[model samples]
Target chain A: MLGKVNHIAIAVPDLVQATAAYRDTLGARVSQSQALPEHGVTVVFVELPNTKVELLEPLGADSPIAAFLAKNPDGGMHHICYEVEDILDARDQLKAAGARVLGNGEPKIGAHGKPVLFLHPKDFFGTLIELEQL
Target chain B: MLGKVNHIAIAVPDLVQATAAYRDTLGARVSQSQALPEHGVTVVFVELPNTKVELLEPLGADSPIAAFLAKNPDGGMHHICYEVEDILDARDQLKAAGARVLGNGEPKIGAHGKPVLFLHPKDFFGTLIELEQL
Candidate 1:
């Protein structure tokens, strides 16, 4: 069901600083900041050899990551995204196995414009998992 | 410079349950638990196509993750490991760039028998980072 790790999303209070840290300090190629108003977050991609590290910042008043930033002021790893061949099949299997799909249990177009669904952290040992259709 | 992401390490309170969640529920190939007493962790590797997810459990009273697990009882993402060409060069460059290295600033043999060094989370957007020589 699970394929490659698509990316690890890290929520940060400041996107510029986080981007600079990964680009200048860590010597990694980072992409420009992209604001997703629909998702209520601004993100920058830290491109690694094998995967990506997404640095996210709250965008609007009701940004999903706002509460997370409030709790983790300095920011932290928000979620891990894994790729799947078929998201609906994956969601059904996960649901049958007693895993809770977040939201309406329907896949939403994610940051990469792919269908994605989030699983409850409680069901996965306190780790928020995002399943993206590859 | 950073290479591929070596692996993402998740510290779990219960290794058996965590492994089962990945194996049985998520349908991923998981390796047998390997106890690294020297590092104070017992870990299982979740084999993914592109990279690996390391599930860790505290191996001793003095385990470094003990404090982390105490705060996050349900377990959470511990650290992100990035592969480096040379550990010493990476450490020196990171130090020069004002990033603080954990411990005595020397590379220690990590779980995979590679020289690894941990960076201070405070210096990296509150996310623990591990640099492993590839």
Candidate 2:
């Protein structure tokens, strides 16, 4: 079963401008930015009392967010992550229920250093979902 | 100041299929479907322990989701909502900081029966954000 939302990620064309909107304008506390080359993204976490919002930008031309940014240009809400008790159990349950898990069907260490897996958008009505084990 | 996230909205083409996937497959508790004609959309709320996911489908051909669906046939994540303690203060602060509040910059009663307003996607890194007064 899914727990509370872990973080909602937004694919942004410019991370600085995007992060400023939350940090400078909204006055929300934000975490230091981290670049994850493995994921091909530069991430910044905006802290909220209840949950977090992750801002992601393409690390390079070959980055996956590049494709998304190409279509959106201005960037947009990319995906949402929900917490689960067990990554393997959640994956198995989701797979049995006909949901397609992304990657090699195994959970990888996400930005939070937790095992996370992405679900196919098609199976989720076109919304890409990430399951993070807490 | 923004409170916890209230809900993330997804524009769906088929409410029945979308709601069923969440209810049957994901096992998330869902609320009864409600159609808001003035907004020209039908909405359903998927209850998560910490937050909610709202699914929106065009009530008719003229519905707002119709245009979005035309662009994205599979449906997709539409917008995300953040709870604010005082909407007027939040709106003014956001406006002063140069954020574009969608529509007439006036809050409307959303499906949750709370005052809500949408921020333009352009000003917020292409993510349409909803500010809700809790």
Candidate 3:
């Protein structure tokens, strides 16, 4: 069970190129752009009517996004992030349901400075999912 | 470059069980339910404010959804469907941009009897994206 989708993260090779493609081709505009060194990625936010599209580009060769791009060269949709009320409670419930937590068993700063934690894709499915608590 | 998110499709092992979980745990009501044999799947629609969530479960053992569920047992988000104006035009543009089309290069009956086409996830990272024309 999840709430409103906070954002859909798309992994790209280059933020500038991907942002421009979404902007020029799709008419989606960048509302915000920030680099999260902790995650080893840079993100550009495209504000949609009700949902936002997040463009993520790996900052370094060692970045996880880079590996994902290597595995999937077309650079498509990455993860679906759902907004939650309490990060801890959600994490506990998910863990109880056998979902593996990727973070340090605690909420960490995410893109846009929101508290977030990632659930291992192996535990949920092939899809990588993020739980964000604003 | 996109409009509002039409719906987020999640692949589950059992539609009834998944729908019940989303309803009981997340309070999401099932707005619609249907079986699309062409797609070899059954779908349950959960209405959100601006975007809806589609729960997908394979109809048979040979169904594609079943293969996906086998690859990732936990069952999670599948595809991010974007509402498009013209399915044919969208497919043409996507092909021009080097994206692979999964369908017979034509829109067919989708969940809720809407015309839709699927873009090969291999063409756009690992995410299977669907373009639905309402």
Q: Of the candidates shown, which would achieve the greatest DockQ relative to the real structure?
A: 1
lDDT of 3 by residue, B43-105 (tens): 888776567878888886567788778876778677888877777787778777777889578
lDDT of 3 by residue, A66-97 (tens): 87788767686678788888888988887776
Ordered by lDDT, highest first, the candidates read: 1, 2, 3
lDDT per residue for candidate 2 within A1-134, as digits (tens), equals: 87888889999988898888888778788888899988899999998888889999899657878888889999999998999899899889889998899889989998778999999999888899998998
- Stretches > 4 Å off in candidate 1: none
TM-score of each: 0.99, 0.94, 0.79
Cα-based lDDT at residue B19, candidate 3:
75
**TM-score of every candidate's chain A:** 0.99, 0.94, 0.89
Of candidate 2 chain B, the 10-residue stretch with the lowest lDDT total is B59-68
lDDT for each candidate structure? 0.95, 0.88, 0.76
Tens-place lDDT digits, model 2, residues B28-70 = 8899999898788999999888888999999865886787889
Model 1 share of native interface contacts: 0.88
| Per-residue accuracy of model 1 over B46-125 as CA lDDT, tens digit each | 99999999999999879999999999999999999999999999999999999999999999998889999999999888
- Candidate 3 chain B weakest lDDT stretch, 10 residues: B24-33
Where does model 2 exceed 4 Å of error? none
Would you give me the overall lDDT of model 1? 0.95
Provide DockQ values for all models, in the order shown: 0.92, 0.77, 0.42
